[model samples]
Target: MGYVSQAESSFPAQVGKDFEEFIALSSVHCDGWGISTNDRQHAHAVLEKKVEAAAESATFQKVIADNAADGALLHLRWATKGLSISENNTHPFVYGDYSFIHNGSIFPPDSFSDFIDEKFKKLIVGDTDSERYFYLMMTQIEKLGLAEGIKTTLAIIKEHGKTTSLNFMLMNKESFVVGSEHNSEKKPDWAPADYYVIKYKKDADGVLFASSGWNQPGWHTLENHHAAIVNRSTFEIDVINL
Candidate 1:
């Protein structure tokens, strides 16, 4: 999941301005694209050849800047366990006003299927386990507060980790949560890969968090199993343990 909040006079009015270029570089993620804003204008686009082409075009950046949002989440999915790559099988799945995106799979979605409520089950419009996982987390958050919901969700994944990997990235208008193991089983070459989180207080009213150093100084690494919560306005960061 990706999160972006703009200052009143931010340099790039739209986060997608940069993100569309990023997505263009990520041809591997070809399923679909999902976007959300703090104002509740959610967009889920079916990523076809044309979309990819447009993402590569010069106008893509300007168009996204025109659609700038205060806070946004963008997703580019590489279909794994899902069916045909349609708009419905995209990332950044939304429920109510909440939006989520995932990076890893939760195998045997049916195994945890019963753990979710019927109402959430009805929201499953696609065949991806990632979407189900998103709904399950939403359901948990609805029943429990953010912290409790994370703990409960992690517990379920740890219990099932023996059979499947559950690496995920989730976010809403206020914050983002990333879950994953240290290594990638699919690409043995990435076994020693390390994940880091950086927190920054750009100004008295702005904070930023990112997985990697965005070529900016003061980017810090997030500890494993820790959650990074940023005050959307102040950019103050609070790292919480799950």
Candidate 2:
């Protein structure tokens, strides 16, 4: 549902072929589109709160071209869990300084509410499992460091709850983290194989991370249940067990 690029260099003026193909595959995902970028302002983001498909939105192209950020997170929403269609539900949800998005569903959607801190509960403005996943990670990050926070949160989701797919991207001004984890063997008929596949590559300018639907050349598929962590300044990357 989203794509992430490392912050070492400027992003393309327009969204690329991979994005176009992704949208063409399903225009229904066009509930709304949001982008999180590390432009002059750290972790700044923009949202197009329209009901039209993003690939067909002139505003989407103009904003993307106007703000060629060092790092960017692009998301297209496909409503699930009976969530409503609105900008507030769109992804790249900002809390404190972090921007987060997800490509999977968490079973028992509201279960994470109890795990969320009372203070952070007020920060939850959306009704999607992805947003809950983001806040859950935030709660852990508030207690532990970034990596430990995500690691601990994921562990709980896998053990205590049922995650059809835990694939996600979480970014701040300094760096970003992404994961490719899911129940590949137990998918329903409606869930496509592309839903579980994620690919990553260190491009000439920076790095690229995305779900398989994008179809960018030279991207290597990430192993299931593994996460990639990349630093913004140094561009150092590590693939760790999730």
List, residue by residue over 144-225, the lDDT tens digit for candidate 2. Answer: 9888888999987777677788888887767778888887866557766766788877754567777765566877888898
What lDDT does the true structure give each of the candidates? 0.54, 0.72
Question: Which portions of model 1 show Cα errors greater than 4 Å?
Answer: 4-21, 40-54, 57-63, 81-83, 161-169, 173-182, 185-205, 210-218
lDDT (tens digit, per residue) of candidate 1 on 13-33: 322244334555345566555
Model 2, stretches more than 4 Å misplaced?
A: 1-17, 40-49, 186-192
Name the top TM-score candidate. 2
Top-lDDT candidate index: 2
Provide C-alpha RMSD values for all models, in order.
Answer: 4.7, 2.6
Q: Which residue pairs collide in model 2, if any?
A: none
Please give me the total number of clashing residue pairs in predicted model 1: 7
| Residue pairs that clash (backbone atoms under 3 angstroms), model 1 | 197-220, 197-221, 197-222, 198-220, 205-233, 206-235, 207-235
Candidate 1 — what's its lDDT?
A: 0.54
Instruction: Give me the displacement of residue 225 in model 2, in angstroms.
Output: 0.5
